[model samples]
Target: MTHRRAREAAGDKDVLVLGVDVSRQMLGSGLLDEVHLHLMPVLLGAGAPLFAGVRAELLPLGEPVGGAATHVGCSVVFGP
Candidate 1:
């Protein structure tokens, strides 16, 4: 869904997106409020970077929840 559609569908609720390109679009367009990153142990080389075209911004991460994968939550801070 486009950002407007996503916003309308997600009124006063959270939307979990699993696609990298979609996430990039949301983040770049300043449509994301927070980000939760699930880091796994295994790595498969050759893929698009998460923050590829997004501008530099500070993302203060909260305490990580660990398990088979580590989950880290970050609040998106927009603008200088």
Candidate 2:
């Protein structure tokens, strides 16, 4: 089954994270209400790339929030 199709079969409300490659393939394939990401401080030399193929825009969620990067939760804006 296609990446998107498989994800759909998994049912909605399932917060799934695909690899960069799979994400790229499944990008823009389904409707996502909101995506939450925990922005953690510290960066690795190399790691999997998120949103490599995602086309949705990311907007901050909740009140005006800013931190040192220890941990930050973000919301992604879906749809045009």
Return the top candidate by TM-score.
1
Steric overlap count per candidate: 0, 0
Candidate 1 structure quality by residue, lDDT tens digits, 26-71 = 8888878788888897878667688877774656586899999998
Question: What would the TM-score be for candidate 1 when compared with the true structure?
Answer: 0.78
Error of 2 at 6 (Å): 9.6
Q: Which segments of candidate 1 are over 4 A away from where they belong? A: 56-58
The alpha-carbon lDDT assigned to residue 64 of candidate 2 equals 44
TM-score against truth, every candidate? 0.78, 0.44
lDDT of candidate 2 over 42-79, digit per residue (tens)? 67677667666566776656654557543333555655
Q: What is the lDDT of residue 30 in candidate 1?
A: 84
Off by over 4 Å in 2: 1-27, 64-80
Best by lDDT: 1
Evaluate all candidate structures by whole-model CA lDDT and list the values in order. 0.79, 0.57
**Candidate 1 C-alpha error for residue 38, in Å:** 0.4
Write down the RMSD of all candidates, one decimal each: 2.0, 4.3
lDDT for 21 (candidate 1) = 82
